[model samples]
Each structure stands twice: as structure tokens, then as C-alpha cells.
Target: MRELKILAVVVSLTLLTYYLVEPFAHSKMHPHVDAPNYNFPQADKVTDAENVEKAKVALEEAEKAGKEKAIKSAKTDLANAEKFEKDTNAFWASAKAAIADKGNVANGEVLVTSNCTACHSIESKGFPPVMDNASAAAAYGVVPPDLGTAGKLYTKDYLVGFIMNPARASKVTHKFVDGRVHPMPGFDWMQPQELADIVAYLESIAPKTMTDKEVFHNACQRCHSIKYGDMQKGTMQAFTPDANIKTYMGKVPPDLSQYIKSRGAKYIHEFVNDPQKHLEGTAMPRVGLTQASEKQVVGYLEKVGDSKKAQREELGPKFLIYLVIFAIFAWLWKSKQWREMH
Candidate 1:
């Protein structure tokens, strides 16, 4: 019994050491080459040129195969861009009607106080104080126009244009010394009434606080206000959304709309469940999902995409695989020790 116990201990230690040493030993192993070359950079450049030509051929073939697909995608982008143009016309019409209505000023006050305070501060009772046009001119050397009498300075069409894309407005005509390109960020995320409220409230504030007060320090104030004071944030494309995720998978990720439209819901459901089936060389990891949860996400995309809902359906298989592997290793270790003991 004593000899058996000692043998079992020795066997267990040997197994544990083998497991730990295997990774380091593998790393140190050398290639059995006739001439060992340490210059990966030179080799990589030569390999890269060959790969580039191959990629060009592949891309041309893909484009040829999906010419209609490419055109459809471009059209979709054009349609979404046009939506903004229509929204602008509707916004101005609403603003003009609201100014004529008696209750509009009151509703505008509520809307402005809630959404505009993050940047603008007009002195309304029980509201955060914003620098009036006069105060702003005194401090910043630029007069911010009062919004209250907007009809006098800007036509209804002009107001609509400004609301739609404030950054694109002309500098000379409006004495909008701040221009449509004023440092003030546009109110894009707000609802239609909320945007109208801001417009209405600005129209009211022009006369009351015409003087400019000093601008406060904000998240972008430090670097932007000092160095790029005169420069506008350009429409430069720095980082594309989901680019990193696509790079990891070694493939160009299709635009969400095109992927869904071409492949159909069932393909997306299976691809999310098991990427290996759709593309053999795809580096995207499988995130296991239940049939029911997959259906829920498919239903959601009919209205809008919800990543959180899809993820909740998918993350289980990875966890299950880890547990299974760990169990198998533990069982093997125990069984080997028991045999040594006998």
C-alpha cells in the first residue's frame, strides 16, 4: 500500500509537469530548414506583393458577381440621405405654425429647458442662465442673435434650412456672426417638438440677454477651443464602425441592411449561431444561441436591430465548451493516478 501511494504521487507530479512544460517547449522548437532566415520583413514584403495581386483578382470577381448588390446598397444610402432633406422642410413648417399659435411659447419654454441646457443658457425663471446676444458680444467679441424675433431676420425657409443642417448655413446674410457653423453642436438626437422648442426659445432670448457671457469649459473645450478655434470638425472618415470586428474576422463585413436583405433572416440566425457553416475560413467565433432567442432577435430586426438581445441568445456555447474541456482533463488526471496506485 505504501509503495502504491508513492507511485501514484510520482505519476501525478509527472503529468502536471508535462502539462506545464509543453507550452514553453513548443515555443522553443526550431524549424528544420536548410537555410534559416531571421529576416521576416524581407520575406513578408515578397509574400505581400503576391497576396495583393491575388486579392485584386478576388475583389474583381466579387464585384462582378454582386454588381446589382453594390448598386442596391448605394441606392439605400442615397434614400436615407434624402430623408434628412424632407425632415428639414417639415421642421420649418412646424416652427412657423408654432410661432403663430398662442400656446407654442409656453411649450417651447419647457422643451428648451430640458434639452438646450447641456450647452445653451438663456435666463428664464427657474431655468439655467444662457448668455444673451449682448452679453455674448461683450465677452466673446461675437454677437449671438436673439431667437425670439426669428421671423424678422430669417425667412421661414431660412429657419428650416438652418435647423436641418446648422453647420452648413451661410455666414454673411444672417449676422448669424456665429453662422450656421457656430461652435454650438446641432440638436440632432431630440424629437421634433424638442427641436422646435429650442428654435422658439432662441427666438425669445435675443432681446432679453443680448450680451455674450464667457463660454464655459466643456468636454471638447480644452484642445478644440484653444488650438482649432477657427477650424471646424471636418467630415473626415477616421474610424469606420465595426471595422475592428471585421478585421479580426479577416473579411469585409457587409453593411447591416445588405447582409440582412440578401441572406434572409434564417441565414443570419445560423451565421450568428455557427459562423463555420457560412464561411469556412471566417475567423468570427461561434456564440451559441437558443432557437427561441434567435427567433426573438429576428423579430426585432423587423423593427430595429438590438445587439444586446442577440448576444443574450448567443454567449452560452463558448461557456459550455470551456466547462466540458476542463471536466475531461480533470477526469483523465484522476484516472491516470488511480491506475498508477494499483
Candidate 2:
């Protein structure tokens, strides 16, 4: 009887924790995340981004009909729908045009050396970072990614915006407010064509196809290590630990293998879009990856971290039913035992 009572207490406490305490804690730590948006939501508003063409058509039709009032109204609607691309935000348009310019690879290489070799390195092309790893960590608080990988991982629009304004592109502008300097400075002065040439140079050196795991590492493993099971070398340590990196980051960046469970897809998406929103002063910069690259990275993380998630979800209900039935039987047994004692 005593043993049964003890079992009942343990079960009750476990049930309470599972049902109540766990949920409350989860609400706090949250999957503060958003659904994947394949279209780069932050791209500059294009003149025809929406169904503004419908309004334009209406305006043309009204002009032909000679309805002055209708034409005027249609014109207003058209204007409202289409926001012309302009400086700072016009990167998408300019990048598209420059890429269409078919990028002079030679010019791009020269531009990259002239403008970028100071802070970044293109190891694929033998451009070592101006400051060695330790010095860069001390100065920038994190080592910059190799531009070669960056070009492959980020889209034209994203790279242009990043070059123009690193803080804005990464969506960590919040952290840059009030005299705090962002590590990456803005190069808004560069012409869109110049930016294009640099990107073109990067693409020229990139392999046409890459594995998803390789994509994730190229995008993340410079700073974050996946100790959960690893996406690198089939071992849990995708990246080696370093004191310089730790001091730069205030700690070793958390292993990413299990963040899919803790942060959730939505949180990860939101985080990639903007890091300062969640962790105000984290050394991790907002990646500002376009929808495609972002999805790839998150998907890779899910693959590594949550392989058994579907299976666990499938079995959850059945296990819960078993626990409830067992609890009911236990309650009845306890009641009968007490009755006999009485």
C-alpha cells in the first residue's frame, strides 16, 4: 500500500511537470520563430512588385475612355502599389542589372583586392585576411567569413545590401544605435556596378554545385560549431574550439545541432533575419540570408538536430493515454486499500 502511494505521488508529480511546468517554461524560452519566407521579404520594393500593373492597365483604359476622373484615381492607385527602387534600398534592382552586365571577372577581382582585402579574405584566391585570425577576433569580435563562400551562400540582392550597409543588411541596426559601432562598416559609397563586379568575381571562383551540409558550414561553421552530431567530418565537432573566438564571442557559440528543438523554425528564421531582436548584444551578426539560403541552413539544422522529432510526436499521444489509464487504475486501487483500512 505504501509503495503504491509512493508511486502515485511520483506519477502525479511527473504528470504535473509534463503538463504544466514544462509548458510554462517552454513559453518563456520560446520558439520565437516565423514561418519560412522563400521570397526575400526585405528586398527593395520594385515598381511592379505587386499587381500594380492592373492599376496601370486601368489607367491606360481610362485614358482611352477619356474619363479624366477615373484616370486620376487609377494613377494614384498605381503609384501607391509601385514604389520605385532607390539608393540604399535599390540594391536589388542594381544588383540584378549588374549581374545582367555579366560581371567582368577581372575587374571584380581587382575591385575586391582594392576594397575588400583589408578586412576579409578570399582564401580560395589566396587573399589572406589583412589581420591574422587572432588580431581580427580582437578587433572585430568575430572572424569575417571568407568572401568566396559568402558569395555562393548569399544572393545578389543580399550581398549588395550587406556591402552597402552591413548593420541594415543584417537587420542588426538596432544594436548600432546610440553610438555603438557595428563591426562591419557600410560602403554605401560604392557604385552598384562596382558591387556587382565584386560579387561576380566571387561567383567565378565558386563551385557550381555544393552539398547542403557544405552550404551550412560555409554559411555558419566559421563561428558556430555543431557538437550535437556534427555536419562536418561526420563528427560532432564541425569546428575546433578556440580561445580567441571565445573571447571575441564572450563564450564559445552554442552548439547548433539541437537548436531546432529549442529555438524552432520560426525563431531561427526570425533570428537569421535579425539577431539583435532576441539576443540584444550577441556577437553573432544577423545573417540576412535570402529566403533560399536561409531555408537551406535551417533545413540542414533540422536534419542534424531533430531527426527523431516526427517519431516522438507520433508516439506521444499513445504514451500519454497509457499514463492516464495507469493513473486511473492506481487511483482506484488506492481508494480500495483505504476503504479496507477504514
Q: TM-score, each model? A: 0.24, 0.60
Model 1, span 1-342: residue lDDT tens: 675698699979888778876646743552111121112222223333443454555556656777877656555544543453344334444444433433355676777566545444443344443555344434433333323334223333334335544532221122233433344445445555545555555556534311111111111111111221212542212122233323322344443323344555766665654443444335443322224334544453422333344565577787788888997898789889999999
**Top lDDT prediction, candidate number:** 2
lDDT, candidates in the order shown? 0.42, 0.70
Tens-digit lDDT track for model 2 on 76-134?
87775454323324544444554445567799899888888888888778887677656
Worst 10-residue stretch by lDDT in candidate 2? 38-47
Clash total of candidate 2: 3
Worst 10 residues of 1 by lDDT: 211-220
RMSD of model 2 against the true structure? 11.3
